[model samples]
Target: MLYLCIVNQTASQNAEEFGFHAGDIVQQWLWDDDVDDSICTKIEDLTGEDLVDEDYGTAVDGVVIWWRDGDDEDTLADTIVDATTMLEDNGPVWVLAPKPGRPGAASSSTVQSAAKTAGMNAATPLTVSKDWNGIRLRAFGKGR
Candidate 1:
């Protein structure tokens, strides 16, 4: 199955000591511009990957889109940017799976609790990490 990993580049850069470099690709695209034409084109051109508009939503801002293709990880970057990027980016943030029954799926309550335990304040934006089931809270704020 395939999984989508969305991230906010700006936030990710600010929160982490290691910032995004030339290879990092986020899942979101500017909402105001021609989402299909402008953003998708940029993704295709920059990352050599195609964008599918079927997953479009108000929450999506940028993405480090990923999916499994025959046991191979398909996406644009090497370093896994920290979750802080989402807060700075203001993403409705989402993960799109190619099929159901993915191993990473987690309950909403679990995500909330995990975030809280990590000192993720309500004022901070949320960052979701994709696991085998679906979504998991990776980090909250500029976690050291």
Candidate 2:
């Protein structure tokens, strides 16, 4: 599945770095200084033409942004590519999942329950693959 990851460039440093964002789709390693509260407004203020249809929300470290454009593979791919490019070049990307009870933290149960919350019917317990950078995208299914 194609995913878009919007981030702050100044904090991420450079495009080649593939900076970490808390809610980023790619899931990369992260550090202590990557956390920030104002990530949403920053993403909203981004002056890019490609960011037109982006739906903005709040994630662990920064803003959660996604596109609502029609189901076009090329368009989705292009947007994801651009967003990642900007994430790396523009700022220090935060990819780490915040610990539970912390300011921007997400609980382990929440991560594990993604499938159930999404209405995926399964008989086994949800197992989340820890990427240590961001959330995991797991295949919805029943356990043995």
Candidate 3:
């Protein structure tokens, strides 16, 4: 016997494009930062998951860390550590930063290095929103 599964093309496309999965428990680590509601709504619409805004409160399937250039490295590192602890096994963490040439934009290298320090591996870059780009990284001790 053979079986076929049908999926929504548009949802699948959005998932692939945004690096989000349906039912994922996404924690938006804002660090007291403000993000446009439209961006948050778009993510929810695409992934069918509710965004959680908390400080390392619960285990999550995915995490979106909002960062800015000129932010303190030590503070960022501490947040990364906390995020790693709260992430579910094999969960991905995306570091969202301002796009290059934008005010308070962090370089790609900086994000990559931070991921490395957190014992995560950078997988791919994603354009998450109009004002922010993301670097997707996998948590340590899990195989993709």
Q: Pick the candidate with the highest lDDT.
A: 3
Off by over 4 Å in 2: 1-53, 56-97, 119-133, 141-144
Residue-level lDDT for 103 in candidate 3 = 78
User: Against the hidden true structure, what lDDT does model 1 obtain?
Assistant: 0.32
Provide the TM-score for each candidate, comma-separated: 0.24, 0.25, 0.76
TM-score of 3: 0.76
Whole-model Cα lDDT of every candidate shown, in order: 0.32, 0.30, 0.71
CA displacement after TM-score superposition, residue 86 of candidate 2 (Å): 19
Residue-by-residue lDDT tens digits, candidate 2, 76-114: 334333333433222322222444444445443443343
| Each model's backbone clash number | 19, 17, 0
Candidate closest to the true structure, highest TM-score:
3
Tens digits of lDDT, candidate 3, 13-32: 35554556778778887544
Q: Compare candidates 1 and 3 on TM-score and give the better one.
A: 3
Question: Least lDDT summed over 10 consecutive residues: which range in candidate 1?
Answer: 71-80
Ranking by lDDT: 3, 1, 2
How far in Å is the alpha carbon of 7 misplaced in model 2? 24
**Which model, 2 or 3, shows the larger TM-score?**
3
